[model samples]
Target chain A: MTRKWLRWMPAVAVPAVIAAAALAGSLPASAGDPLPAKTPAEVLALVAQHSAPSLSGTLEQTSRIGLPELPQAGPSSGSGGAASVLELLSGPHTTRVFLDGPSNVRVQVLDRFAERNAVRSGDQVWLYSSKDNTAMHLTLPADAGHTKDFGHYKHRDTGMHGVMPTPEELAGRLIAAADPTTEVAVHPEVNVAGRAAYNLVITPRTEGTLIGSVAVAVDGESGLPLSVELKARGQEEPAFKLAFTSLSLEAPDASLFAFSPPPGATVKEIEVPAHGTGHWGKGHWPKHGTESGVVPDAEDPAPVAPDAVPPDAVEPDAVAPDYRDPNGALARPTVTGTGWESVVEFPASPASAEADAMLSNDPLLQQAAVAVPGGRLFSTAVVNVLFTDDGRVFAGSVPAERLLTAAAAR
Target chain B: MPSREVPDREVPNRALPIREVAGTDGAADVGTAEPPSDRSSSGWPLLASELAVLFRRRRTWAMMLALAAVPVLMAIAVRASSAVPPGRGPAFLDRITQNGLFVGVTAMLVCVPLFLPLTVGVVAGDTIAGEAGLGTLRYLLVAPAGRVRLLLVKYAGAAGFCIVAPLVVALAGAGIGAALFPVGPVTLLSGDVITPEEAVVRLVLVAAYLTVSLLGLSAVGLFLSTLTDVPVGAMAATIVISVVSQVLGELPQLEWLHPWLFSHYWFGFADLLRQPIAWDAFGDNALLQAGYIAVFGALAYGRFVTKDILS
Candidate 1:
């Protein structure tokens, strides 16, 4: 009797699990929802009606990972300060747009490196390479025609794979697959971002993989994606969740899309790798603009508002006073031990072997490596003081150029 | 006589055939009294009992004692230091303990590419080799114990060492690290700081994951030990394999190749320290390591059970 029951146990468990999964995937749709009959184009058209050209906000992001019991990170909230956060609210296939805002009509495309990030504000799209100090700015063409077909994964045969599918694209595809035959529940609810949103869940019409259904919460008013949760065909728990924070719908200047190189700045055309083409996506930007144009000053060359503060509002008229002069926290150099003595100051550079040696030895100096990048590259220089008692023990970057300059001046 | 599990394909035709023996001492008169031969003559269970005897060695005790002392010493070092910049923090000492654990794990990691899987390789590397070097392998093999039992015994002893050594080192290191380093608030990669209790739990989890990761290497070592005569060669080979894999695992160009290598998951435990825990990478790492353990373990069992014990 026990042996017979054990054989039937597995058979009973499989069908029971299947039924439960089927029920879980097909949550009843609520009333007064009109999205059930819309195709991708029609769905996008509905989105375009209420959507604005641009959205901007302040973003404080904290990304972490690990098990729930022992998580990867603690909460770290850093202030983004007065900087404007921009995201162009668009459907998955809407890759490039000619947006007119704080600066007037230029081109904006979802940034591929930043995982299909929407471009919200600012005229010039500036990106700097950390490895090399090279910078690039992109501009929209005057015609603003859809010259390049973007966001078509199926059109790869025509040598056009613009970028990986956006989160909204995935959500749209899931919804479209389940439209007429199956009803998806759409609910208005608050998401992690503390904003009201329409939560949409799609259940496929046919038999499929474990994740036969998908759910996403889109900001109802902004048309921006706030969060997404996915359920597999068999599982009760969500397989994964992605959340976007600090959403807004403010308009941006149109001119922010136009890119003009500074005079004497070298302009080189580089080909960017297409997404989902192969491993390691391409990085080179399409080169069309020439460097002959006078580089606009870092200051806002074309101010949108009359009250718009100049970009370089914090610049001093003359060289700042040296605080090390008696009144400074470091008044006089106290002679501790007998050796080589002098206050030395130099900017941090990887090329400087001496600075590496000094910084590597002092634990406090390590943070300097990461800090230099967050600020203007040329703004602050590293001030180094060397007190060498045993010359043989520690020979600081022996051929000091600044020391040579001082010696030559004397 | 012994029941063998070696696949028929790998069994050499030139290998010696086993003869039936009536009693425990039946093979003694024929000079097949070596521990491994005796094990084959006796049985697998008897071999396991012999492994317990091998663990009773003074040298094994001393080695374990020394390894167990490292964390305590590390803890003392951390406690004695005046100001531990991030450089001097518990993480650094934790790294030091990691280095020591890696030495043992590397022994195992080295075996995956060439030798048997890691755990088998570690035991196999030292098994006959260590015994042969000590001139006890021949004696043990020739004793009432059969060759198979001797092999099993040695493997069991090594596995016991491998599991115990890492835990002791981790516990000692963490204990010392906690005592020596400032234990107030632990800063994490996510810019969130954790209290001492939370940090302790995370560290313990990290150590436990590391132990699981090392199991594959240990299995490989035991398997390799069966193939070689000198245990040092097996030991050296194991370490070399680990070093090479570690080097290969770091190349950015071959980032895709990383998921396949055993060492790829070595630092995965550190992910636990991150806030919210990045499980995508960690889960992938855990799955990969578990697969390695299963494959290496099966290979070791098949090889040891079937291979000719000429040594």
Candidate 2:
């Protein structure tokens, strides 16, 4: 009888062994050999001096805005097929990023059975969506030069951009625009993507703002920003984060950057009429309007809007500061305050019938938006967008009530 | 689900083969309990007979035909509809009208969560319990089929069903889709268009990936079958586990447990359709399935070897 009972021992033992093996594997690889530490200012200087230009890696991005969960469709096509950037409103996404100096960049947003790619080589940018098998091509104007001014390319992707921001880009933007009212600190040691790094923490001093503090994981060796995490005020967890799960400092293949639309893909050519660069999305993406032909003062896409505002608005200038232009080339995006508490209000532009219908029909948008006295208010962990009844938009990385007050004042 | 009623009838039909194969089981070995090696010594004959019995059933055929009907019904529905569905249905569903090939992919996606698993549960749960329930287990053991060989044979029969279910869905989908809609160059998930030949290859890979995905479930069902004399209970339990695993997989709060769940990668077969097929999910799924088979296969062995044949 004892021997018969012993027969069942294998059942218990096997599963217990397998579970132990899995638990061992999931333990984060020991933060091996911590790198020498640096102060927050030293890390900032390191980022300024960092020059590892050519690299390839995969990025994992997750958001915890407390929105409704994303559909279980499959890394979904980020800001592609649906032409609704809000489609990526929640959930984790995996994007493969490749770069080779200033001339070539490729970002592949992986969906379950589909992919969306944004490839930039020389003066050409090709955005391809495998779900619909469609490709959009845009040629940069001569003045948008191929020199190391990659910041121009970042500006060009103001609205409805297919790719998520690289950790380097987000970290740089946050650090570059850090004002006197912000404090910078550093955690001496940290590990990310299996590499030792410095955690540069930046906190805003002002109150009445939604943002708490932002942390950038700066690679100790190459000074690359391996990850960027943002916490909303009063939240322990990161409200938004984009980080590299793996990294390779070597240059990606040149062939990766040389993208041509697959043979059967429907190709649409976008002609940039005048402003060497303007926002790509007006409404529902790739609007075939060569009609915004008013040649402005050729402004180098100014750093007007505070980078933290994650407005769900489709318009880019809707979040940019509104400074009344004397020449009336383009109405200034109205920013109400300075620094962290700033609010940007949009000039009254009539919403198209199609956009109104689209917004009304999207279940995700409906769930996030609530009725206010004047209009509808939409919110995320750190940003708010109040769609005023009179065809105006008020947005900032502030609470919903602040945005409503700004809308009423306007 | 009326398929549950048919496996009981299978036991009676299988009685004839048992009599012919183990003709000398005269109940003399009932006391000392040495299995009478009255049949052939070779394991192949027994394995072949086990599989033959499983496939010969009306329930297996009914389940397969029902699975095949999914794509047929979908293709016909899409064909009968108006010119443009215009953003209707799930991910690959909208593309079905443009490319007939998408029908198989879409149908597979819809069925993976429910239909494939239900059939797998039935076949696997029916393996041992159905024999014990019909008073035929003593006769088979009296044929002196070693307990290990019988267990392996039962598992093989279950695994065989897993392969057929998904293939039936994919092949039927392709045939119906090609007949109804225009078939042309297949555009992959990476936007790369491949020739029809390559598309067929991708479909086969997807089918194979799905087959691997279900293998773990079959083992689980086989283990559950050993615990009870009622085949229906085992079948229900197996299906419940598959559904529960998927439900747990969907919850974000239990994300730490998701990777360990067998169903976590069930839909990952779609990776086979991508231009440069992502092989990571395939390898991981096979490893996870192997783990399940190892753990549950041993449990079934332990339980079945010790149980006294009373039915």
Q: Report chain B TM per candidate.
A: 0.62, 0.88
Angstrom error of the Cα, residue B252, model 2: value is: 6.0
Clashes of each: 89, 4
Q: Proportion of native contacts found in each model?
A: 0.00, 0.40
In model 2, where do residues sit more than 4 Å from their true spots? A49-55, A70-85, A147-163, A249-265, A281-330, A347-366, A371-376, A387-392, A400-410, B1-49, B56-58, B76-86, B94-100, B142-149, B175-183, B247-261
Q: Could you give the CAPRI-style class of model 1? A: incorrect
Q: Specify the highest-DockQ model's number.
A: 2
Q: Write the per-residue lDDT of candidate 2 for residues B41-132, one digit (tens) a residue.
A: 55666667777787888999999999999999999988888754323455677677777887888888878989999999999998889888
Worst 10 residues of 1 chain A by lDDT: A81-90
lDDT of 2 by residue, A1-410 (tens): 67557768888889999989988977766676777767778899888788767888888888776666655643233233222344354677777777787667777777666676777788787777766667888886776664343543543542223236677767766776466767888976667888888898888888877889888999999988899988889999888888998888899878777777866567988766556434442221232111221111112111112245432221343224223222344445556876778787766643222233334566655776788898777667777767777766676887788888888775
lDDT (CA) per prediction: 0.38, 0.70
Cα displacement (Å) at residue B129, model 1: 4.1
